[model samples]
Target: MDIQKSKQLPKILIITTGGTITMTPDSTGGVVPTLTGNDLVRSVPDIAKYCECEVISFVSKPGASLNWVDLLGLAKLLNEKLADDSIHGAIVVQGTDTIEETAFIFDLLIQSDKPLVVTGAMRSAMMLSADGPANLLAAVIIASSNMQSQGTLVALNNEFHAARYVQKSHTGHLHAFSSPACGPLGCVLEDKICQFVKIERKSPLAMPKNEIASVGIIKAALADDDRLLKNIPALGYQGIVIEAMGAGHLPAHYAPYISEFSNKFPVVLASRVPSGPIFTHSYNFAGSEMDSIRRGAIPSGLLGSVKSRLLLTILLSLNYSPEQIKTEFHERTEY
Candidate 1:
């Protein structure tokens, strides 16, 4: 840890997106993550000691049930925060359940050199053994440090991960978050951030051109009802993203819907399960990965449906072409 108090600390804004880190025990003994921005500061006094921090909290709700509106709102706030020249970086303390997803979205939307770090605790502050302070401290350090001045990162349980690859693996373990295919971009040691990788590099991807483009996610099931496929195009959406089965396989009954959506919109397919990119020609059915790609539909490449949707939204917002959307979706994301 840098011990000199004379060194000027970077101005970091801790945006509270709500999570276990802010939660405390209620009178009834039930745990709820409802602490406000002020309460968050008090929980981790070490943060104030580290650097100059100005907090701007958006939501006090759980991060598990995040919706599209929440993501859009958060992106707007992040854009405003980065606009300030005095702000060196920002930290978002969010629920572990959707923190990775949210961070991935922010990475897709925001293109800045000012670091954006997302951190959360597995245990609540009111718990007997809490990890909130450590995680929060790590986040503050990562945000203030010159190491990760660009790109979206997750600082959790002493591990630093790229926002795109990180995932919350365990429900209760301190080391809940992990980057499956890709290792961590950096790691937190004591109170310092040590960077080991630099994968994200390039300008942000542009949104695709669509009259109305929306990302629609559907899970696989034995008796799946793809009424969503029939209903989506009519709902003013021009793009479709299906969270297909293992290796990007959709049920035989749902083939028509894929064909139908592909004809109308830029349909992108992804895997519902964790790890691995969705690749075509992995399966051999008539309308398998091969057929899906042979049709107008495009594969999500490496990103899941959520990230794919985010990239699609950005590209669509910028009026990018179908080929452009496919290419930009995999564009190297840099700070």
Candidate 2:
């Protein structure tokens, strides 16, 4: 624990993971994660003015390398920590590549009403104008504010976005994270957290008896065949999220495979488009969203492929039957 400020300030846990934010130029002329939680906090000593922070180096790996078990473990740790009345909130620092998914997973599973924020930088700390320190400062400021019960938030580029709608819009831009369909929930400016939207937070999912499950997400492209789709179940995947083409429609040839897969494992239909709800009706095509659901696949509603996979994995880990999974999936996806 590194507290360089007044004890009267609210306390927030700073959980750091390896990401671009913690990376530095390595001897091989490439950026690598080499900073600890304490190092990151020290970079933004101004955060101490907002809250007394506890630094915990959770892991030192790129966000893309973080797996389902890492997410489960992080959520468990946050839940246990926030359950203590003395702890105000927590901020998770990791790579931006997976920040949206991490935020959404924590949004679904973290029961604490205290504010929970996830943030990372688009550039490495060695970059000329690295944004990690500013982002980290913004996140901790939000955590110390009255942003309670607002669900998981992604803070970057001085903006705060809800977990459900926020996504990585660009690869290298400083303003990489954005909530497409829905605008950002808030922003940090002049050291103040200002919110512009209010979203209905998801009811926290119960901790699964099994913390591990395999789910694959396949994006449908033009002329793509079902060879990869067929191999998913053969590879022993427990569930699937198909990033179907516009409005959740696959090729006519996929209709049969959809039926075959949905019969054995849960199939979730999410749109390839960045923002919008999955169409529930009005399409008569063989592989339309309605057709897929009729064939036992579930609709992802407004969720994209990345998030649907996480939700489906949790459902499968719970041993949910296809029908039961359908019911829960629909309820959770609905606004």
Candidate 3:
């Protein structure tokens, strides 16, 4: 971990997208994204000694407000920068609210072997004991290391998590990100990076067209009716993800409506539980998981509702047929 060991150190790019990490107090007692990429680098001067750095202030908005178009643009920018022969790796700073989705999208779009890391903070930069500088330093260290060729990563609280498995489990804490199904890939020590597990990379997906399909998500409740479900097709929704109840079951009254909806459009059934796969044959009631599958509801194995919605949206936008979509779900969810 000596910066002066090699004649030419690795060059890293830090792409800044506004989040709590870059927000400052405004006149009305609220905070806004006023800090630029240069400001962040100035806060932590140690990063410059580790690697040659370049900064780009991409966007300044909350993660919830970011849509598909914004993500597409960010992916394209990252691809262009990583394609450069001198740029060894890149780090993305964005809001934690949508990091899971954005990181997964980057994982799908970026085809380069160079490492890409995403980091953010729960507390604002002006708060006491702000965690932004530390998190950003760790991310830069990971990006500059010899861990190239690994897939996208989320670095926070000194832990490195794979983009496919990481999630924000807590609302207010320094250690909010975690990988429930799979543990973190590594941890950043004082002067070294330790990797405990290795992850296999998947093939990159083609860039989606401008006209992406509209997708919706619905969470099944105890006594939920089918009024909204029945109106989705008429409302112009191309795909849907149902956050079904335990073991991925709906009420008996919803079974017929689910079958009817599935026949018209792609309906995915995912469990509401946090860290488990959708059950295939645990129950056999009229509205059980097996029944839904029998009625053409595709099971979203271990993917949560949010991730399932994104996958369905991308697949439908790319014009994948129903059978091809089903096969993809099977292949991705296979343990």
- lDDT tens readout by residue for model 3, 168-199: 99999899998888889999998479999988
- Between candidates 1 and 2, name the one with more favorable lDDT: 2
Cα displacement (angstroms), candidate 2, residue 22, comes to 0.7
Residue 169 error for model 1, in Å? 1.9
Poorly placed runs, candidate 2 (over 4 Å): none
User: What TM-score would candidate 1 get against the native?
Assistant: 0.86
TM-score of each: 0.86, 0.96, 0.95
Shift of residue 310 alpha carbon in model 1, Å: 2.5
When summed lDDT is taken over every stretch of 10 residues in candidate 3, the lowest stretch is 1-10
Candidate 2 weakest lDDT stretch, 10 residues: 225-234
Residues 1-335, model 1: lDDT tens digits: 12223247677888887888878878998778777766777667787667777777787878886676777777777778888987778888888888888888777766566888888888888787788888888888888878544578888888889887788889889988888777888788867767778874445542223333565666666668767656777787757678888778888877777778777777878788787877766676865887788766678766777777767766777777888876775453211
lDDT of 1: 0.75
The model with the greatest TM-score is 2
lDDT of 3 at 195: 95
State the TM-score for model 2. 0.96
* lDDT values, one for every candidate: 0.75, 0.88, 0.87
lDDT of prediction 3: 0.87
Q: Residue-wise lDDT of candidate 2 within 1-69, one digit each (tens)? A: 768577779999999989999999878899999999999988877987899888899999999999877
Candidate No. with top lDDT = 2
